[model samples]
Target: MTKKVLVIEDSMTSTKVLQKVIQKAGYTAVCASSLYQAKHLFDQSMPEEFLCAIVDFHLPDAPNGESIDFTIEAYIPTIVVTGREDEQTRSIIINKNIVDYFTKGNSQFYEYLSRLLGRLERNQQIGILVVEDSRAERNATVALLQRHNFITYAASNVADGLAQIGQQNNIKLVITDDDLPDMSGIKMVESLRQQHSKEDLAVIGIAYQGRPGLSASFIKSGANDYLTRPYCHEEFFCRVIQNVEYIENIDAIRRAANTDYLTGLPNRRYFFNRVNAILQSPPAHISLALLDIDYFKKINDSYGHDAGDAVLKGLAELLADICRDYQLARFGGEEFCIFMPLALSEACQQIETLRCRVEKLRIRFEKQILNCTISIGITDIYEGSIDDMLQYADKLLYQAKQQGRNQWISSDTKHRS
Candidate 1:
């Protein structure tokens, strides 16, 4: 379902601003001017539809943060925004069961809110493991994570925590207390680092304030971050978010490096890496196909370059859809490759189907209805290396193009039109 955010604010200006921020963060904003209006609007929809609620601390009719109470009572994670920046206002909002509170002091507040909303959405997919012997502490940590919509797992000891981490592939972050039953948290962090790099998984170690060198030990042991036992909620969240974002940013960078910029397909380097990994075990029957768009330069000359790009993207999308069971890549301009663990006959049939589909595809660009065809060369011969397979496939592909456009040629069989 497309999640929504409930914005209860009396000011039209603030409501409009919040709506823009929420929409930019990829969520719909349901706005209300007062608590009564919020209730009426909320009654028309299900609570589950809302990702969270952003409410003004003081509404005209329901003054003094009553709207915040209503949202909390309705079980929606509430984020309070107040013009009052006093310590008492901050205290009152922080004590309540809310996601976070923001004081409307500067433009950075909305900027942070935009980021926070995005984090809440992403947190739904991120699983966090809490490892603490104290049930109370573990529950509290889990509760805080859940308020931000994270998938949470709990373990009472280091051994159980390690087991959980191995079992739960979705777990991206581990928050562990220094004192554990099976092993010290620093030791656990060190053990975990042997298997999971910092970019793959993040660990935050918690040590009591009186523990002089424990925090530094945790850091040296490969914990991404360390938290003090008596830390405030704000400090705790900052550390958690910092560590999580570190992993996510690294992932984003890796993906960018491996992906083709225009068509969003795997690039040549990534394709080789994947095919090489598969070649290590050597499938019983392996096939590779090199495809080139027929008359690609002609298309670019007849139409605009934009239309040519549209054709490339359309072909990539088709390849992704039909070759879901195989590895695919855009090997450069007007060229693509697919690696399949299928016999020559099976691979030939699939490539023939793909060629026919490309011929039938109608790519709309501007006022033009453009169509293109692909010539494919496929080979089931795997001579130890992916490079050898690619070269053989390229020869067959050239033969297909030489014979006629929109046809598939197999190394072990006759060319098909």
Candidate 2:
């Protein structure tokens, strides 16, 4: 199918160029020059027909971003293009989570736009792998996916197929036939189901010698979608497409849950989850640190909140550069935390190194320059649970603040068993 994209851009010349580019990229494109025209186009174009949309931040009708909101409410993935870099535009773009914002004059505008569309198109296809014993059945399944333009892979029976699965990354959907020499497909599906969440990996079973409603057993065996022998090719392909889409949606949501909005780090909830997991079967034992910026409150009060944000962002960059392997998070206002499994001593040393880099970080605002200092509280996990480790680190961090505001305090306290 030729992919359909509705472009709501005000510049007729730019829209014409975009139309040519999108068409050349093999998508059927529609261009609208204003909010009212966009509404008319949307009304005429059915939702199922258009794959997604691109919206301009300021249309002639709604100059302050009202039209983009309307488009997003329609459940289409929309990318925002804007001529203005105002605070209001940035806030709305962040709040609505529109896709991404691009200032039109940024020399890379055309490249970014092209990349966004490509990502959306690839996201639609969703990858699948089919495993069957019969050459004809396997080819039929592979043919069904290829006809739909879905990127696909196929393997014969249990052993060869599972080997393929381990080697292939992002193999979201799997179709397996139950009978095999190495192992039964039911057992394969069960093993995968036990190892991965239904949302992350979808398993569908196919059988050649089952009675009516036999697909129910496979569904019970943990397939997100089911199919039987003698199935219509169209129905089978549609089922495969639906499962792939479902798993991708689920993967997206899971990622969002694991991420933090402000500093773009893993949030505290996700941090604790890793800590708990480490305590269960921790290797060589890891170290945890409770790091806080000293005099942060004074900085927040002296400069505006925006500068304070700049400081936090600057520090986050520095930390990521120095301790790339360790997991870090903005623990709370003016405080952050890090956990490094194989490098507790090294993590402590790195945080101390970061403090020196952070102190030299001269943040410039409007006309003034500002410098900041950070203090770290470090503890290695040699005893106790994750909670106790945090408590130990927090206590040490409290001590670091006392021993003058810019020092790192590494305590010999044990906080996990």
Candidate 3:
């Protein structure tokens, strides 16, 4: 369901702008011009339908941020936008349990607001671990993170922190204090580095204000960033977001490297890496098959290359849907591969079903409805190397093409019509 963001502002111009920004961030905007209207609208709808509320710090009806209080009391995360740009105003807004506050000064404010909205939506899926020995400080940190919609885990010592990190795979960032019961924060960072790289997991160390060289030690021990004891709300959230974004950016780059650009499927390199990992502890019965479109080039020659690409994309979607349980990839051009950890008979049945589905698939390009079929070569040989298995499958594939264009050939069975 599309989550809604309640916009409570008095100015018509600001309300329109906020509505556009919220919609651009992939959310619905529910607008209210005053505190009373906001209450009425909110009462008409369920509170769970709202992701958060963006309220004006000063409204005509409620001039002292009463709407902000109202939203917070209703258990909705609130973001304050005010025209006041004084230090006193900032202190008052930040003291409340709000997501963040913004000054209506320039275009940059709205830009940052857009980014913050996106971050709030993404934070729902991310987990963070806080390691601090003090119960009060730990609880305080967890509460702050919860306000931003993050899944939070707390540990009172290094041993518990390490255990939680091992158990929780979604934890992307770890914030640890300098003093812990089991070990020092620097030592904990070192231990964590042994198993996870800086790109895979981000660590932030916290030290007192007068701790000389402690920040340096944390960085040297593989912490991505560090924080001081008297950190404010803004500084703490800034450091946490920066470290988390570092890990996320690296993940995006790695995914782009492993994914095919055209069909959004795994490329040949990623397929080999995945199958090789599974091959380490080889399955009792494994089968590999290579599939090729029967007359892919003819489509390009008759219709155009665009039509050929449409057919390839259509087939890739079918392969993804049907072979979701197995390892599959597009091995360049018209060739695709599937590795199934099943017996030869079972693999044959699955591949034959896929073949029939492809035969019936009609891809529409411009005004033409094009139909295509696939030829498959399968083998269940337990070869030591993947290269050898692929070579065997390729030979069978060639034989299938020679005998007939739309048929399958297997090493242990006769060619089927």
Candidate 4:
């Protein structure tokens, strides 16, 4: 799949030049002579198409940058191309918060556009909550963020900042000035970090004056990084971008560790970790159940190992599908586990749904018919020991086998020991 570039230009020469540059740089080039044509192409193209866009200010449809402005409004990462390069013109361009800008040059705008495209390719969106008591400073930080292409929200103080943080789940970065009329920013960062879950997130403390080792204190108070007031734009952007990317990388890594490979479910390690969590309290009204296949070993032996593998996978799928509201896991070979946070009787109602679904699964392996059923051993939390619960369930499973397979034995009633 080639990365597609959408170039909206009215100039035939410049359009041809950009198309050639794009091809040379190894990206497929698409050209639109007017905004209508550009929109039409966008509507026709696949949703996943078009990595980035370059829009010319003046077009045949309407003059004075209509196409470029509309493209930016459409929420695509767009670079504005125009012959005007005066400070006033640049101010207007920057005010639109365009991702990048390309001025007409002898080298052609393709490489410059490609630089922004490169950034867009690796670019990750950073959610930044800017905390400022003064409206002036808040507007200043918001402008700075627009120049750097960061998604930002503004808050007046500690309370507002926390509220915005709660509202935006993607918030990876926070910038707060130290001298709020109420609640010093350093104290806010400390309090937030404690409640903010040590998961991937960054905080940078900003202050107008140097107040005796405040930077060190801020870092120690659970901020990832910090900056003094009256700083350069590049310095601020660098620190903010770095911290956001760091947290995002950590989040990606944690996800890989906890997710299961085969069925994309939470694997046994995570399941047991949760089980330990559920075991912290006495098993008063809580229940646990261990489900096993009726004749798993014989199914594999008679229908080849692949069929056995299919049964196990099919059972796991059915378990996950039916027990959508239950704590479930691929416990091990030929065995799966479910934990219901309710009394034995209520949990039985929930588990029976899964039992009936699996019992009806007629898994086909070539000509051989593979019908399956499962037996479950249920027990209460009863003083909160996983060891005791496992023993009780194991005893019930043995009982089910003795009484004949494909039957559920409730340890809460059938075997109290």
| Candidate with the greatest TM-score versus the true structure | 1
Q: Which stretches in model 1 have alpha-carbon errors above 4 Å?
A: 413-417
Off-target runs (Cα >4 Å) in candidate 3 are 301-307, 362-371, 415-417
TM-score of 4: 0.70
lDDT of 3 by residue, 35-102 (tens): 99999999999998999999999999989899999999998889999999889888889999999888
Residues 168-232, candidate 2: write the lDDT tens digits.
77688888887677887878888787767788788888855446555777777787767767775
Overall local distance difference test of candidate 2: 0.76
lDDT of 4 by residue, 205-251 (tens): 88556475888888888888888878865577668767766876787
Estimate, for each residue in 1-417, the C-alpha lDDT of model 1 and write its tens digit.
679999999999999999999998889999999888999999999989999999999899888788888998888888989999889888888888788888887668988999888888898899999999999999999998887888999999988999999999989999999888889888999999999999999999998888879999999999988888888888888888898899899999998999999999999999999988988898899989999999999999999799999999999999999999999999999999999999888888898888888989999999999999988888887768888888998998898889887888888866465
lDDT of 2 at 283: 69
Instruction: Rate residue 238 of model 2 by lDDT.
Output: 57
Off by over 4 Å in 4: 1-36, 39-67, 79-96, 100-128, 139-153, 163-170, 207-214, 227-238, 294-318, 361-371, 381-383, 401-403, 413-417
Could you arrange the candidates by TM-score from highest to lowest? 1, 3, 4, 2
- Each candidate structure's TM-score, on Cα atoms with residue i matched to residue i, is 0.94, 0.64, 0.93, 0.70
In model 4, pairs of residues that clash are: none
Q: How accurate is candidate 3 locally (lDDT)?
A: 0.92
Candidate 3 lDDT score at position 98: 95
lDDT of each: 0.90, 0.76, 0.92, 0.76
- Alpha-carbon shift of residue 131 in model 1 (angstroms): 1.3
Q: How many backbone clashes does every candidate have? A: 0, 6, 0, 0
